[model samples]
Target: MAIQSSKTVSACLQWVIIPTGSHICMAEFFKTSVTWVVDFHYEGRPRRWFKAFGPHDDPFQQMTDTLKDLYGDRAKLASVRKATDEEELQYLRGEEPKNSYCPTGR
Candidate 1:
């Protein structure tokens, strides 16, 4: 579930509860599950990464999450697009593309 706030809430107040002053709402955002091929840079070298997202997942948000998990502020996402069937198959089969670099920095 994603927590979103109304316009009435100020930017600084968004992080904390105003008790009786602000109105906050919790909403569920949903998107179709998708397999994405993400192009990014790691250690100044271009690389590729793939992942399947859940129905509620956002691709851009996932990219940020990946950046935090893998590079801790160094990783940068370049491109994101739906994965082709062959690419998805390779990802599922635990195989990496011959022409692209894919490494788990962790």
Candidate 2:
């Protein structure tokens, strides 16, 4: 009876269906209530940043070189992992640094 009544009352809601891909995977599902947001984060730092040599001494490579030149071995030519946000904040705030030769924190 409820199903019959529901069929009698037509809903004016609009729906869109796009079947472009071969298999329909629900991996990116987040729209049951209408707010769309997608931000991807890596569990570890990108492997490209850890390389000893990068893209022919370009900006990233040059920056790494500059740090090594300025701070030597303490400047992290090869880091075990990405610095956490809090650690980076401490560096910016002069709360702590691995090396004392980096001039005044201000």
Candidate 3:
């Protein structure tokens, strides 16, 4: 059931059609979520930000979709992964370097 639901979520993130009878998973069922630090270069300058990945979400694709909008087709992705505890803390404390970082509470 989880696998099927994951497929559904993946399809949804990609805007792909999921055939009938596919299971859908709710975000509540996911107990472990991660805060990703997305670093990239958009239009020749570095852009950094945080994005949360919930249980029903596809992390990489979400970043791709989001960065695409801001960075355009030529955006260069530097890295995308779970944020460290220190990184998260710095962000919460408003100490992160000036960038596109937007603080959304975990």
Q: On a 0 to 1 TM-score scale, where does candidate 3 land against the true structure?
A: 0.56
TM-score against truth, every candidate: 0.54, 0.25, 0.56
lDDT of 1: 0.68
The local lDDT score (0 to 100) that residue 98 gets in candidate 3 is 70
Model 1: which residue pairs collide? Answer: none
Weakest 10 consecutive residues of candidate 1 by summed lDDT: 21-30
Q: Kindly list the per-residue Cα lDDT of model 3 for residues 1-106, writing each as its tens digit.
A: 2222344455447444454433333344334667779887776777777766786677778788877886578787788888999987887687767744434321
Lowest summed lDDT across 10 adjacent residues in model 2 is found at 32-41
- Model 2 TM-score (2 dp): 0.25
Candidate 1 backbone clash number: 0
Root-mean-square deviation per candidate: 12.7, 15.9, 12.8
lDDT of each: 0.68, 0.35, 0.68
Candidate 2 lDDT, 6-101, residue by residue in tens: 333447633334454432333223111121111111222222122122222244455556656765655443333334567545544656433233
Q: lDDT per residue, candidate 1, 1-106, as tens digits? A: 2455667867766643334322222122213457888888777777777776766667878787878797986788888888999988887787756434424422
Model 3 CA deviation exceeding 4 Å by range: 1-32, 100-106
Q: List the residue pairs that clash in candidate 3.
A: none
